[model samples]
Target: MSTIFLAVGLVLVVEGLAYALAPSFIRRMAEELPKLADEYLRIFGVAALAVGVGLVYLAQHL
Candidate 1:
């Protein structure tokens, strides 16, 4: 559906902007990611997912 495409496009735009605007920062994060524990990363991922779902719900209702 169009909504799915739009969501993918928006994600790409935001991700692209991060790399374009702060290449070094992205690189540093990537470099340090491996040093992070699996548990912390899993928690971060779950938190991000929750926020993303909440945003989508708000956007749809509001």
Candidate 2:
């Protein structure tokens, strides 16, 4: 659907902007990620997923 494509495009745009504007920060995050614990990363992933789902739900209903 067009909505799906738009969402993907927006995500890519934001990701690109981060790398473009803060290349050093992005590299630092990538370097630090390998040192992060698996459990911590898992929790972060879950939190991000929850936030994303909540946003989509609100976008559709509101």
Q: Which of the numbered candidates is closest to the native, going by highest TM-score?
A: 1
Tens digits of per-residue lDDT, candidate 2, 1-62, equal 99999899989999999999999999999999999999999999999999999999999999
TM-score of each: 0.98, 0.94
Error of 1 at 57 (Å): 0.3
Clashing pairs in model 1, backbone N/Cα/C closer than 3 A: none
lDDT of every model, 2 decimals: 0.98, 0.97
- Model 2 lDDT, full chain set: 0.97
**Residue-wise C-alpha lDDT for candidate 1, range 1-62, written one tens digit per residue:** 99999999999999999999999999999999999999999999999999999999999999
Which regions of candidate 2 deviate over 4 angstroms? Answer: none
For lDDT, the strongest prediction is 1
Q: Weakest 10 consecutive residues, lDDT, candidate 1?
A: 5-14
